[model samples]
Target: MVSSSSVKIVSKCFVKPKTIPEESKQPYYLSPWDYAMISVQYIQKGLLFQKPLGSIDNLLEKLRESLAITLVHFYPLAGRLSSPEPQKPNSYSVFVDCNNSPGACFIHATTDLCVADIVGAKYVPLVVHSFFDHHKAVNHDGHTTSLLSVQVTELVDGIFIGLSMNHVMGDGTSFWKFFTAWSEIFQAQDSNKTNDLCLKNPPVLNRYIPQGYGPLFSLPFSHQDEFIRPFESPILKERMFCFSSETIKLLKAKTNQICGTTSISSFQSLTAVIWRCVTRARRLPYEQETSCRLAADNRARMYPPLHPEYFGNSISALRTAAKAGELLENDLGWAALKLHQAVAEHTSEKVIQMIDQWLKSPFIYHIDRLFEPLSVMMGSSPRFDKYGCEFGMGKALTLRSGYAHKFDGKVSGYPGREGKGSVDLEVCLVPEYMEALESDQEFMSLVSL
Candidate 1:
């Protein structure tokens, strides 16, 4: 197991939004997506469990005190979006609420596993599900806003803590940093040595200052419609899948052999296979069609390794085109190569610089129609297992993406460190396509290997 000290902390300085008067001085306006992300930095969540010798009230008091230094922004819509600018100050307040009576705060001091378990299960879904709801519409202010909510639920035998935040506020990396800090505070308070914990500097906020003109600059739609609209939907479903680590390694090795190309990473190869499998199962026409886009995190490419603590939205997308037939007909090597090229070309400094420019353009949103329908959203090599799984009771057997709406396909893959060549992939596809792929002998063989 890795020690917490070894984990890197990202800076959070830039996450705080400047006052309206301060922001008006700048010539450029924050893209709608960026504006929403900035608001996420001010929100916070805490988990209070009943330990063998602990009182829940004591824990809550300690947590409230410990978090005093950080600003806590809250909204009334527990699972919906809130306007960025509230008509009145203190329109919404942040306070703890119990499951039995959500409007009233509950402060109980007890230690019970059953209580913890029920709370944990409920909290998990509550925190994750809220994001999808908030993104669907703008708040009362007419500006698109995101809400942050905290729910306390009972786990199977212990209390589970859940935090829900808007994606526009911060990306996964930034959110993780906030979580780790919160955990550290809780741990320090539990041990009665809060002063020993060191607080790091916050992240620097560098607005996407446009560089030379790129694709986003001449786009056909508004900035809000481009990135935010893709994620809007009223309802969503969640699913989870687990694969033995050994199976993933074998598949990667096989892909390397078939592709005859050492340049492809395991992630690219796996995504290509999934794309082909889904398309074939759906019996979708492949000729001259581009049906998918990959959500690539631009962290490393933008500034070497991204600081985990740097909060706010710092991501970009890469578009790929291929006929369904070509992907299915190609060997693993060919598919892997195509995937690699599609991803790699966009990793260049030029591409990132171009994206920064496009986001700043007033016409950024107008270009959405030029692209093909985005069928799948894929993210590879996430470090879920290595993150905070240990803090929650038993080790997490599997980590999967929460339910998401809007997109027809979603998949995330991460390496399993314990097993040789093993990878963990969580896929979300339409029921029909999922059923067809499950029944396909060739597709099953590839995934199972």
Candidate 2:
């Protein structure tokens, strides 16, 4: 096991854009959907890689240079959150101040641990959390904090590139787009190409404000301090369980057979299995209500359809709930149907209606909302191209998350390193539930070795 003590900080600094854009003088207003995440923690994720054969100093400088260029197109990320402004009596709103941007934070660290120390562990090692920066920071803290922080942790035989992005700035789609652009720029320079970095699909920086709303809609909180959600670290266990293509095929077949329907997707089927097993492990009362909250992209679901590369929070949380006993008692196909319906029903009209409702009465997601009783919250998607993040060394060995936004029932889904319809789930739960989950034969039988 790798001890947290084995990790040591080497250097830390802010890496600004190579040049400031004149348009950055104007503030980048956050949309209503962005404000919904003000109380939650930043997104903390990283990529593991085999050690690059070169001086660590050279590697760090190359990454810093490319990131600086990448920020020019995504300048809001380099900006700080503006101080809350009063929209009316006892209400406030915030925006990103791109003017005089302080830039993204970059840290270089070294660890005595190796790739095997992390990838081979039964439970994610505590030291893995050390690889990422901004551990306890919420998105509200972006005013005086770095909206983005990149940490490069040098391991004995590998490197881990960990990143923390303010949720107010973007969702996973936006985050990965920035990562991809940075990689593209770096690869161009590595091949001794011209300085003009040609991004395939540049980020769409314009904020989307709903019609007939906002001169700045009043936020729910009267003051900034109230936006900080109370979070006490719980003793938790996190394990990555892999589902191979064959396993997923079996799951889809089983679910379709039981539900007597062929419309349920592999993603729905796999998530259903997790929800059922976790609820069973919790051993809650038969009538207790349980929920599974999935983050759905609203870019394509919106009227006129937002650019696929929209660079801000354009996601809506879709929740499905059922009685604990009802969920476990029903066949897996029945549970999958609930999720499928949730996805199917979130059409353009519904997305707009929800946005309109939020404009009327804003509800900021807090720690309590995240850790709903007897529930699981699923974030991230297996569709995110985690393996494509390569900085000339090679493709990522694997993807992992840090300590932020993690609670008893938080689950992050990822595409398995192996291609061909495989899946991986990073499940976090309290010790008792984790033990029960790992021991549950019904759940473990389909796990890929």
Tens-place lDDT per residue, model 1, 367-418, is 1342335355565444532334233232333332333323356566554434
User: What is the overall TM-score of model 2 with all chains considered together?
Assistant: 0.96
Residue 49 lDDT in candidate 1? 41
What's the TM-score of each model vs. the native?
0.64, 0.96
List the candidate 2 regions with Cα displacement exceeding 4 Å. Answer: 84-88
Q: Looking at model 2, which ten-residue stretch has the lowest summed lDDT?
A: 83-92
Tens digit per residue, CA lDDT, model 2, 174-275: 888888888888888788863886688899998888877764666766787766684655879999999998899889988888888899888899889999
The clash count of every prediction, one per candidate, is 43, 0
| Residue 139 alpha-carbon offset, candidate 1, angstroms | 8.5
What local distance difference test score does each model get? 0.44, 0.87
